[model samples]
Target: MRPAHLALAVLVAAVWGVNFTVIEIGLDRFPPLLFSALRFLAAAVPAVFLVGRPKVAWRWILAVGLVLGVAKFGLLFVGMDAGMPAGLSSLVLQIQAVFTALFAAAALGERPSRLGVTGMAVALAGIAVAAVDEGTTGPLTAFALVVAAAACWGASNVLTRRAAPPDALNFMVWVSTVPVLPLLLLSLWTEGPARDLEALRALDRQGAGTILYVAWITTVFGFGAWGLLLRRHPASTVAPFSLLVPVFGMTSAALFLGEPVTPLRWCAAVLLVGGVAVTSLAPRRGAPARRVDPDPAAADRAEVTPSR
Candidate 1:
């Protein structure tokens, strides 16, 4: 990658890292589902107009949206709202990589390399440590919800690979369009019109603007830039940088939310980062060579020609 691209990647990581903080802020004012709905709505509208439609099957697009947008974010927000700490949420969400690897193996017929297996094991160990640290009293249910969110993300990865959108930008734009309505419906049904109206009416201008910022800058721009990076680089090259998210998340939470990062959690972070590195940095095995059919005319010409 060029220096410019590298810089952009760093910027994206920072944005995503701080996203937990942003979510915490937004949730203080709005319900989780409503906050998520508004975020997606903000992302989808201008994106639909500017990027237009992606050249993909409607089913695939919908699947992508349901998995990535509705399932992932919805579960994440719920988990956070249910008492999962923001710093912990950031760390736990990294489980998506493990889920993605497992899904790829199961759904795509891809075999895991030795390094991949090791990486996953290491990462899992880290998660176990984190879980222990979280303890039974600290909203185990919320943690489970985050794990569910990770599984949804993994499913989305498989769908995305299968769909193989012609362009990432178009794919993102189109898939992003799928989540708004479902999320709105969910918000209405669960949160109720009364609570929704109350929250909307009571929110100060600053809170409303924060939601808009979370939607446009964090969701749309962040994901758009991410899609662009994925299109330009190999997943192996790009995906590992996401490890920084928790690091940033922890730091941001400490600074902004007054959350503490204990020594044990720091150790867990090391194991997690190491595990992810082991899996991602390993060498890939060579694929079997493919045979090509000889041209009929060429074969005939060869038969007619004199032997050398």
Candidate 2:
């Protein structure tokens, strides 16, 4: 990667890593689904005007949107609202990588390499350890909800690969539009009309400002910059940088939310980070030496799509 691109990658990671804090702040003001709806609405409007529609089948587009946007964020918001800590949520969500690998093998006929399998095992064990830790156990159901969100993220990964939109930016823009309606409906049903209206009406300047930051900086700028990077680099080169998100998330949570981090959580973090590195960096047993092929078609179509 060029120095400039590398810097951009790091910037994206920092932005995303701190997003957990943003989400927590937003939730303090707006209900989860409503906050999500507003975020996507912000992303969709400008992107639609600037980038236009991507050349993708509608079904695939909607599917991607529902899985990535609605399922992933909705469940995450609910999980967090239900008492799951932001730092741990950040760590557990990395399970999507393992889910992506498994789904890719099942759906795309891609075989998992020995390193990939071993890394997944180590990561899962780490997750199990984390799951058993007191921090995670406090709100077991919420933690379970977050796990489900990770699974939704994994499903979204497969759909993204299957869709294979022509332009990554346009694809992101169009698919981003899909979540608005579903999230609105979810907000209505889950949060109730009265509470939703009340939340909206009662929003102070600070709360509204938080929403704007999440919508513009976190959702729009973050996704747009990430989409650009993915187009320029291989997924392997770009994706592993996401492991840093949890690191930043934990740090930010500690600093801002005053969330406690225990030794067991640290051990789990080591396993999770190590597993992600092994999964990302280790070569496949029978795979070709070249990581990035000139022909995009020859590149390994693993299930784990970039999460820009």
Candidate 3:
């Protein structure tokens, strides 16, 4: 990558990192499901007109939308609202790499390298350590919810790899269109109309700002930029930067949210990020040397590494 591209990559990673803190703030004003619904709605509207026709079939779009947008994000927001700290939630979600690897093996018959297996072990160890810390400092159920969200993310990663959309931005914007009604309905059914109405009545500039930030900035800008980087560079070269997310997430949380980075938390961050780095970069044994763009669907899902 050129120096400018490197800088751009770092910027995107930072945007995604800070996104956790933004979500935490958004949760203060909106119920998780409602917040998530509005985010997709805002992201899809004007951008959909701009991004062009969807490149993949509607089945792929709908599947990814349901799993990634609805299941992964829904659980994530609810987990955070339920008391999973933003920084730690960011870190733990890295476990999706392990889940992704395992899912690929089962669903796609892609065997992982020995190094990949080792990396998964290391990542799982990190999850265990983080579990210990969260169990001590926070609600275990919240932590579990985030882990479940990560599993959904992993499943979605595999689904995306299968979809292999050529244009990440277009694929993602179309995917965005699929989730709004389902999430809104889920919010109404579960979060309650009165609570949703109360949140809307209380909405202020900050509340609307939160929606725009997550929608336009994080989803639209962030995904487009990351996809551009992948198009310009090798996936291996670009993938490691994702490891930076938890770094920025924790630091930003400490600075902005006053969330403490406890000793155990620090240890978990190191182990999880390191493990994901290795899992992502390690080549799979018996994986065919296909022409690249083999899995920009993974790219479309907001991660550079198709392996995850």
Q: Tell me, by lDDT, which candidate is best.
A: 3
lDDT of 1 at 233: 68
Each prediction's RMSD over C-alphas, in Å, is 9.9, 3.2, 2.6
Model 1 earns a TM-score of 0.88
Listed in order, each prediction's TM-score against the native is 0.88, 0.90, 0.95
Rank by lDDT, descending? 3, 2, 1
What global local distance difference test value does model 3 have?
A: 0.87
Q: How accurate is candidate 1 locally (lDDT)?
A: 0.74
Q: Candidate 3: where are CA atoms >4 Å away?
A: 288-308
Ranking by TM-score: 3, 2, 1
lDDT of 2: 0.79
Candidate 2 residue-wise lDDT, 1-308, digit = tens? 99998988788778777888878887888888998888788778876898865677899888989998899988998888888888888888888878877776787666678988899899998888888884545878888898899899988988887776546657777877989999999899989999889888988987777777766676677767766676677777777778888898889999999988899999889998878777766654432233444547323333235552
| C-alpha lDDT score of every prediction, in listed order | 0.74, 0.79, 0.87
Q: Pick the candidate with the highest TM-score.
A: 3
Which residue pairs show backbone clashes in model 2? none
Check candidate 3 and list the clashing pairs: none
User: Looking at model 2, which ten-residue stretch has the lowest summed lDDT?
Assistant: 297-306
Q: Provide the clash count, candidate 3.
A: 0
